[model samples]
Target: MLKLIRLEWRKHRFAGNFLGAGIAMIGILLFLIMIGFLDQGTEDFAFLDYQGSFILIDTFARAVFIIFAGVLISKLIISEYRDKTMNVMFTYPIKRHKIIAAKLILVFIFTFAMIMVTDIIMGALLLAVNQYYGFITEPLESKVLWQMVVKYTISSISAAAMSLIPLFFGMRKHSVTATMVASVLLVSIVCSGFSGSNGPTMSINSIIIIPLTLGAVGLWIAALSMVRLETKDLN
Candidate 1:
């Protein structure tokens, strides 16, 4: 498994996706902060409030990283099939399921780490901005910062796991479009429905459980697809 992951990393080491994601992360954070400043009069805007700002940032970060994960899965997995490199992979001695697992594991780790790091950076930047501008109602407190860290941690993990949903579509026909489309829809639903003024529709615990459950289902489908791959003609 480690070997497979190493090989996957080598394949993507030169790819511009990571660099692009990094740029996008910074861009998105700045954009959200700008909106907060521009919309200061709009109390309904979640970014205007400190706690609301964190919630907005967390929701947006999750959505962006989830889409980024979908793109990674599409490029890493679907593109292999599209380009006929999957047949080359099939020739390897490693079990097909192990290969799939390794790829998924890489996606999960990358997505989770990116979201967590970006969220932390964005949160800190917003706090600093608030300190200078006095936009936030409450002063920055250690207890509040700790709560943000915990919430961000949970949301990041859940977002990373949920990203595998696109894998199910990717495996079906090796369609990158399908994977991206699924990601867009999922992100829209998650961000628009449960985030912001509406707040989470369910308990915080359910938010974590629901995405994790869906991710597990997606992995189960990927395992089943691997079984099919064993018998299906690679040609």
Candidate 2:
């Protein structure tokens, strides 16, 4: 399994994806830092508070990385099928199911890791900026930071799994458009936790429910697809 995963990693270095993610992360960071300065205490900026800021940042991270996963599904999986490279892959010694599973594993790990790391970096910047500007004015404590980390970690896991849901759509004819669109819609649904309001829908208890549920569904679909790939002709 490790060898297969390493082979998939070698096949797609994801350099473009990493560059794109870095650019988006920088944009999110700039927005987060500037958000404090733009604060006017209006309802428009209500989600600019500590927790709300975290939610907003997490939302951006989730949405970005999920789409990143979608692009990866297209690049690593669907596009290969469309271009008939999958035929070449099947001719190799590797089992069909193993090949797809390896690709899925890479996607999951990459999405989860990127989301967690990005949130941590952005959350730290939020803390540092708050310490300097006193914009949020909420007393920072070790517990609060720990809580943020816990929440971000959970959300990252959920998002990474949920991201694979698009595979079900993409595999129906290997339509890249369906895969990408499904990802966008999935984000719209799961990320509806906050808007410009003071009452953020993203609470600790509510955080894990939707994403985890859909993530399970995605995993089931992926497993089923792998089973089908064992017999389905790639020719």
Candidate 3:
């Protein structure tokens, strides 16, 4: 499994998708900071509240990651079919499902790690800005900081898992655009549904379970597709 993952990384090392994601993260963070400054005069703006800021930042990060995961799925999986390289991939001694699993695992890990890092960085930046400008209603407390970390950790994992939905789209039609478009639409729905709500008010378990289950189902679909790949004509 490790060998297959390593091979996959080697194939995509220069693809520039990771670089693009990093740039997008930075851009989003800067935009959030700018919005905070702009909202300083509006007492009712959600960004004025520390807790609200955390939720808002997390929402934006998750939205970005959904799109990021879609692009990676397109590059890593859909591109193989479009480029007629699946036949080459099939020549390897490894089982077809294992190869697909490695790719999916890589996507999940990358998405999760990047989201966490970006979220933490954004939180720190926001804290610093608030401290200097006194925009936030309440001062940053250790308890609040800890809560932000915990909430973001769970949210990042969920976002990573949810991002896999695009894999199903990509595998079905082998169209990169369709995969990415589907991701954008899904993120739009999710963000709209939770726009004003706090992070998973129902329960922590609900927060973790829903996205995890969705991710698992998407992976199951992808794996079944791999089984078909074993005999399907590449032509």
Candidate 4:
């Protein structure tokens, strides 16, 4: 498993690094601009409030994941069919389940790392702006901060998880772009319909769980579908 991960990492190092650096830079720029608008001599609104921050974080975090998921899904799954590399991949001396698992694990790690990097950059920016402004409103308690971070992280992962549905279909027809677009549309529809006041704003944990489950189901189905493909002759 470690070897497989290392191999995938080597292949994707450029993409992963680029994603991290790009997001961090964006975060820093946003923070600097926000700080510029702050009252330099006052201590008012210097802290971050969970409620207000939640709105911004939730929206931005989801948007970021959606874009990344689309690109990554297109690249990772589509590339296999586009280049006719699955023949080589399936020829290897590995179990069919392991191949799917490795790919899934790579996606999981890649998404997790990206989100963590994003959070770190965004958090630093928020902190810098707060320090310059007077603190933002009232900085979140450590517990609240961590909770929000974890919640947003899970949400981001779940959002990416939706990509598996499209990948499953894409693998069958060998069209990654089509599945990628379908995945985005499906996720957008679900999120738009299931999110907001029209739906339950239950605890953050509940919100995370709902999509997490959906993603898990999609992955399971993808895996099973891949098993069938692995055995079928491409010719």
Estimate every model's Cα lDDT from 0 to 1. Answer: 0.75, 0.81, 0.75, 0.59
Best by TM-score: 2
lDDT of 1: 0.75
Error of 3 at 58 (Å): 0.9
> Which window of ten consecutive residues has the lowest lDDT sum in model 3?
197-206
State every prediction's TM-score relative to the real structure. 0.87, 0.90, 0.86, 0.71
Question: Clashes per prediction?
Answer: 0, 0, 0, 11
Residue ranges of candidate 1 with Cα displaced over 4 Å: 194-206, 232-235
Q: Write the per-residue lDDT of candidate 1 for residues 116-219, one digit (tens) a residue.
A: 88888888888777778776666767897898688778777777877888877776777899999999988876666444453323323235666667666756
Mark the 10 consecutive residues where model 4 has the least summed lDDT. Answer: 193-202
lDDT over C-alpha atoms for residue 46 of model 4: 20
Q: Which candidate do you rate higher for TM-score, 1 or 2?
A: 2
Off by over 4 Å in 2: 33-39, 44-48, 194-207, 232-235
Once model 3 is optimally superposed onto the true structure by TM-score, how far is the C-alpha of residue 13 displaced, in angstroms?
Answer: 1.4
Model 3 TM-score is 0.86
Residue 191 of model 2: what lDDT?
75
Question: Per-residue CA lDDT of candidate 4, range 1-235, in tens?
Answer: 8787677667767456565648654764575456435734443322235444443444444445554655666666567757877667878997655765677666666655665666566666666656775545554588987877777677667755654666666666667667767666754654442234322233332455567777787678666766776465255
Tens-place lDDT digits, model 3, residues 112-157: 9888888888878877877777766566779878977887787787
lDDT of 2: 0.81
Tens digit of per-residue lDDT, candidate 2, span 1-235: 9999987877787556678888979987777567655756665564446777778788878888899899999999999999999988988887889999999999999899989989888877777766776767667678988887887788788889989999989988889999999999988888776453564535432556777798889889879888888566353
List per-candidate RMSD values in Å. 2.9, 2.3, 3.3, 5.5
Candidate achieving the largest lDDT: 2
